[model samples]
Target chain A: MESIQNLLIGFNDIFSVYNMIIIFLGSMFGTIVGALPGLGPSAGIALLIPLTFGMPVGSALSLLVGAYMGTMYGGRITAILINTPGDAPAIMTAQDGYPLMLQGKGGLALGISAFSSFIGGIFGLIVLVFGAPIVSKVAINFGPPEYFMLMVLGLSTITLLAGKSMSKAVMMALVGFALGMVGSDYVSGFVRFDFTPELIEGVDFVAIIIGLYGISEVFLNIENLVHLKMGKPSFKVKEFIPSISDIKKITMPTLRGSLIGTLIGILPGAGGTIATFLSYATEKKIAKNPEKFGNGAIEGLAAPEAANNASVPGALIPLITLGIPGSGGTAIMLGALIMYGLRPGPLLMVESGRLVWLMIAGLIIANVFLLFSNILLIPVFINIIRMIQKYLSPIVTVLCILGAYSLNYGMFNIWIVLIFGVLGYFMKKFDYPSGPLILSVVLAPLTENYFRQSIMLSRGSFSIFLTRPVSLGIILLLITIFAFSFIKKGRNSKNQDYSEE
Target chain B: MKLMERIFIIGMMIFSGLVIYEGIKLPIKSEYTIGPGFLPIVIGIGIFISSISCIVQSVYKYKKLDTDTKFISKEGATRLGIFIAVLTGALLLNEIFGLLISMVVFMIVILRYVEKYSWFVSIRVAIISNIIFYLIFEIWLRVPLPGINL
Candidate 1:
């Protein structure tokens, strides 16, 4: 009953005129931004964050959350229509979605994606609401040792799950840590790498984010501009509705994907891309007609779409509860939360229950709006895509500059953007993952602070971390994951050598 | 790709060594507890080890590396170079001329020459986008962007 009352209060807060308008506009804007190739949710949120500066915390959060959800659904549009994924996670959707579009069932594909995303989003939210509190309760008992171990686990998991190579991921994450160490130390008040006055305050998270994701993406897209192609989409509005058979085929896959996504999302560093790929592979393996997948199969479209959307809320679970972001989008959101003067962690729920619930309610409301608006505004979105496609690169470049500048109203931030932009481009060129780098930058201060505090608490005894059961468990888990990756790599290389002969 | 990979590994190893060098200058232990430099030293060591491992792996997989190209083509490399030069020019322009003027010039150059769009379309995009940016950032959001007095 109390939970029901809290939810009602949350809804009431979200339904206010200003908040509702913000959510609506944010959703529309996010959808358009997501439909644009090369701009994913992280870049979208980072670019638009400066606009929310003067707004109330609740209103700002509602707008961001709305956009966050909108991007998840909006990414499907280009994936299905143009055969080009608007975001990384949407790549899976494009495999089957484009085939469906080629068959002139583009409307059905869009409709199925929207519907599956809605179902997955709602399911994920339900899990978040229930799971977050339990996670927080468990985390509340953690001291410095456990906190340090948890951060280590977070960094390790992100490294392990980053991509094909574990070494590159570790190298990238270490670079982030190195960058994070540039500022004044929190405990001792000693500046480590302050070669310039600008470095004294630390590298601005927003500057790095805009540079790495937004500016670098522009550079990459510009490099490929010669071969860029935008597909022409044709679909009748009346054909948007999926048939009974299509719905029946997708229902089980959608549910399973949502479940899988939600579970994966709860794990640190396991994000939407992983969730979507895992669910898609699972669906393919379990399907009676697995050959139909990647050839306009509804199951392929539904599973990944569902998993990607579900993973958003799943990613939020760690962010809100533990102050640890599971994905890049949530990491940006965490940056936003910090900007708003709210410390996200176990105490966040206790100190700001109303705001927390309001954000949760805002997500649910946004998903509901997305369900209807995505269908009704499909034509509008398509039209917007055609209009905006030509000017995307220049517009993004301008936004990246302005976004970085607006963070501190300084030219130095712009330089930071340029430097990191080149760095990010090279990283991408080298097949090095950028996700772990951002994650490490975000988590570095907390990890360092906790490590120092834990050691101090133990009177310089390092064994204190192993003495705590929870910390010990996390340490063991990290070691096991590392060992597993090592063994697997060895086996694969051995197999490769055998095959070579 | 092999050369680039070798350069990257060597560069990272040198960078890690520099970090360790600087980190050691800071207090490693302060008041009988871990100091600020401890984590950086640890991270630097980790990077050194990882880069070494990367070098070893690259050596073992030399045949595979031969297939990878750092750039699409020499022309593509020139284009990227031009892009960077233009961006740096824009940054300098932003400092001297301000955001609005620099952005407009930047957009026109990028749209017209880089993207090969027609002059008319490029100017139209530049003007319209600048106006929208001004209205949104300056008027609505109240961001104090560097701009003309007007």
Candidate 2:
């Protein structure tokens, strides 16, 4: 089959000794970074991107994908050992994982989650392998009008889900649009916001990314530097391998969570956080003893952990097939794809099919590698976390500064990082979701070009969007979402009024 | 918190105005198609309208805003302020002392003074981290990392 052939092509690319080593090392390093309290997949990739500047595209992508997968796997450590979740998706893990730790099943909890994470990852990968190609095939036929509508739907969905205040989300997105306007316009060849010579090239969203996710996180972490109260460190190999009964318990929940994660991940903006929450809720509702849900329940722990890892691959589907990122982490990966000089879209497979396949091959290898590495290296990871607790903020700050400076071998991006670091801190403190803003910046140029081209094709008629069947369908979906949100808002306000009375 | 919120809103409004002013100077249309200005102008107006709506929402939301809600404790805020200040100072130092030296100094200052790590521990971490950075970025990556300028 073509799928097997494509995978073979990928394995051929990944088999080189140098490429294999990079994935192995990147995966281990990513786990350490992700296990740190504040760093996530985005920060792990952004800070390490400078190292890949001179490598071959295949190797570079392999390393990045390895790190991305490692972060997903590593998120469980802090959740199980300490009550602190490494990132948002791991929040549900802590609800039961830490409780299980209290009940002296910490080693078993880690083991169960690791196996479940691997299964979830493999399930998502299967879907990605078959799903992306099929989606790409259908997307290849889409015209500019449909592309424009798809982009609007993507941005609108992210904005709506970004924060509690829809208005603030829109404001942030508009700010992103403004930022995206900085460089030369491709269609008209006019520069709108060319205040600086650097602005002539446009705001480097990557620099903004490093600033937002990397440096801003350091700032926040330093504010409340709580030393993690680690549990017992020693775990024998037997303690890590789940028993048959344990496997039987987690099998159905992990599968159900994987299914929910993949489906939600395919929908833009509905990333791992939502998937994990939904999975945890579903498990609780269907549990034989709901009273046991959060008090050391292995099903409660396994489901969200599976969902968390599954959503990583699920988020990649849109990025690979449609050039639309499904989440904040994938948004950065989209930027990386562009940085590698490969265009992402329906034609991505057609043009750079070999490279795409190689990345996929690398992801499969990374997923497997992380499972064993995470289990064996558990003690080492905990020790490292405890050792570096004091000097973490300073070390991370240095890495962030060095990373920004290395972007173009200049000080300009360092300044951008600093300024945006401040702004990003404020945005976080104010509860304004940065996801919509970042997505807006990444998609702005694409959205603008598609809209302009669609208008030109239809002789300046706005009705072109509605005339196309696919575009009309997207429009209807958007309308339904808008109506639903409004009704939900009304009901929420009424409920609040009743509570007050 | 209220003061910071007010400043951000006014700043955003001003930024929106500047965007609109610059956008209108560019041609809004090409040959039967939208031009560069089309998107910018639309975005500027969107930001402006969204800012107004945000103002209205904040007025209602902040009315009963928990006055006692501490955004950050005094100690936490002070530490954050010092962190940013030191980080800014280090970037300036990079122009003079080079990346490695400046960052090492930054590390020392934060560890010894801010977090109160002893001199022995502070210098050990600073030197070790800088060496690793130098080996990776300078030697392996061939990044042309700035050396000691002074």
Candidate 3:
């Protein structure tokens, strides 16, 4: 009942003329930006953070939230119409989506994705409204010990085996963690291993993220540059509705995807990639018709698309309550909040209850906007992509560089953008996920600072983690996940041998 | 990738050792006592452990795999090194030439030379981007542009 009242206030606050206009503008702007290749919510919110500086905290957050949700949803349009994915999460969509477009089901795929995204987004927000206050209260009890343990759990969860082995992922995570520790010591104010003054301020989060995910992807793309030329794929859709069978096939996958995305989103540092991957893998393992998975299946398209958008709201849960960003997009959202003079954390909900509720309401409104805009603009989006590659390619490149540069007022960041663009290219060529590395880099400071503080508080006693029930539970959960993974791997290896035989 | 990983691990270990050595200069009476060196030592130990683990894993993988297996191809590795070099160059130039001039030059040089954009295309992009930055930061946001000439 209390939650219901809070939600009613949220709706009132969000539906105001000023807030609605901001949401619309933000959604439109986000769609355009996300339609461009390589720019995701990170770039969108970062580019617009300055614009929110003078606005009231709720209004400012409402605008940014609108943009964030809009971009994730909008990225799908370009991904489906063109063979190229608009962002990393959209990559999976392109796999089955492009094939569908080639076969002339592009409009239907876009319609399904857009509708599913709305459902997923709404489901995530419902969870947010009902569960947020309780979650925030629980999060408030987290001291450094609990925070550190939780980070360790998050890191370990992401470190589970890739295709070949867990060791590789662990290795990559350790490298990222080490790189994260390069700058200032939060406790003693002593700089360790910072050779230059620039580094003393530490490696900028924006630069490293852009470097690993953005720049690395560019480099990876360059390898295929000679072979690849972009002209929009042509597809015409007479109907946009999913048939009864198609709806039945996709419904369970979408729900499962939403659940996966929402759960992962709540866990700090776990982002859409993990949620989407887990959802896809889970669907594959359970599907009655599993053979269609990598071969233009609608379920494949729906699950990941639903999961990706769902994760946005999921990611917001941690950011609002715990002041922890679950993903890159959320991190950028946090930066926007700080720019608006609203620090996100425990006190935020109680201190500015109406504002928090209003933001949640704004997210719901944005989802509605996303659904209407995506469906109405599908044909236009596909038609516009018909422009020749020579023009579209340069425009996208410019946008990517522009979006990267706009994050901080530094021109050096542009260089970081290009550098990481190339690095991203190479990482993609290899099987290593730029996602985990980028995620690790993003979460490193939080993990390290908390771990350091906890140790200091305990005076070097490892028993503090055990003494705290929440921390103890988290640590136990971490062990259980690893243990489960090990058992599953053994079973998988047996199945692998059987398949081979 | 193996070479790079090994180099990174070794370098980190050496760096960690140096940090620990410096921390030795800070007086500490008890192991449990919080001192300036305590956090540094914890970090140093973590690095050492990870570095050793990385080396062991690299060796373990080497033994497990056939000689034909390639962890990271040479071309990919070289491109990665070049990328890092460009980033380092950008940071250095930012400090040396300040923000605006360095940025314009950085944009032109990298887009044109490294990325192989035509001079005309590069110049157009560089100029337009520079002006946009000027408007957004200096004009709209009121963030003072750093003196570029100095």
lDDT of each: 0.85, 0.85, 0.68
Candidate 2 Cα deviation (angstroms), residue B95: 2.4
Can you write out model 2's per-residue Cα lDDT over A42-140, one digit (the tens) per residue? 888887787888899999999999999888877789988888888778889989998998887888888888898888888898899988899999989
Candidate number 2, chain A TM-score: 0.96
The regions of model 1 sitting more than 4 angstroms off are A226-228, A231-233, A491-501, B65-72
Backbone-clash count (model 3): 16
Task: Place model 3 in a CAPRI quality band.
Answer: incorrect
Chain B TM-score of candidate number 1: 0.88
How much is the lDDT of residue B69 in candidate 1? 56
> What lDDT would candidate 3 get against the real structure?
0.68
Candidate 2 wrong stretches, greater than 4 Å: B66-68
Give every collision pair in model 1: none
The model with the greatest TM-score is 2
Q: Where is model 1 chain B poorest over a 10-residue stretch in terms of lDDT?
A: B64-73
- Which candidate, 1 or 3, would have the higher TM-score against the true structure? 1
The CAPRI category of model 1 is medium
